[model samples]
Target: MALVKEGDTITIDAHARSLHLHISDEKLAHRRANCQPLPPRYIRGVLVKYTKLVSSSSLSALTDFNLF
Candidate 1:
């Protein structure tokens, strides 16, 4: 999100299953270095628990039972 700015071009290739950001490597590196992590939207309850317990979707969205 931080890497993308207004007027920046983006391409989505469904067939290739890829996304392209039309920005220079230098610009991307600069954006990455300056990017800040977003604060958690949920502070408590099931959502918070879910956030802590769930693994990344790349890992198949498995819950870490050890967190329970």
Candidate 2:
């Protein structure tokens, strides 16, 4: 998938998928700080889930994690 944009949402293959968006941890933290309705507990869960998913994916180059 080719990344077309960099922000709260990354557009990949926009020609076929327009609603494809991935919320980053920084964005989630901002939402939690501003009290954007997403619960704090859920925010923690999302962080954990994101970490697990990324660590297991081929996107390891994007991060310096030693995740195996």
Candidate 3:
């Protein structure tokens, strides 16, 4: 599958159980936080989920994520 997009509900494995997270951020904050010692990466068989297209037509004031 391709990379996750906004409004896509993802269930990722967090140690013992699967943790559900919504990927609305453009670059995924937890994965891109510079203050954190380690950054998140795409792990084979670990990041298992599909992307769901978000309906932007309904949202009138949704702020875009800063990817830079």
Candidate 4:
């Protein structure tokens, strides 16, 4: 997947079944290199626990009970 910066323009062609991001490769690479992981939103409690244990939705969001 390509990184799209804020305010970047995107073009979607339904007939062509394609999407394009109007960003230079160099700029995208720079953004990727400087990107930082966001801090977890939940500090504590059930939501925190859920985040730690839940699997991706494609995997049915199954909680790994063994992790608890």
Per-residue accuracy of model 1 over 1-68 as CA lDDT, tens digit each: 66898999999999999989999999999989999999999999999999888889998788864644
The C-alpha TM-scores of every prediction are 0.71, 0.22, 0.20, 0.71
Those runs of model 2 whose alpha carbons end farther than 4 Å from true positions after fitting are: 1-21, 36-68
Q: What is the lDDT of residue 63 in candidate 1?
A: 89
**Which candidate gets the maximum TM-score versus the true structure?**
1
Tens-digit per-residue lDDT, 1-68, candidate 4: 43676788999999999988888888878989988878889999999999888898998798864655
Pairs with steric clashes in candidate 2: none
Give the residue spans of candidate 3 off by over 4 A: 16-68
Model 3 worst lDDT run, 10 consecutive residues: 46-55
State the lDDT at 53 in candidate 2.
49
Error of 1 at 30 (Å): 0.6
Which whole-number lDDT from 0 to 100 does residue 39 have in model 1?
93
- Poorly placed runs, candidate 1 (over 4 Å): 56-61, 64-68
lDDT of 3 by residue, 1-68 (tens): 13444667888786867666666564566456544443445434434221122224565323443422
Task: Give one digit per residue, the lDDT tens place, for model 2 in 1-68.
Answer: 23223444555686786555486767556655666343455446777666544544565434545544
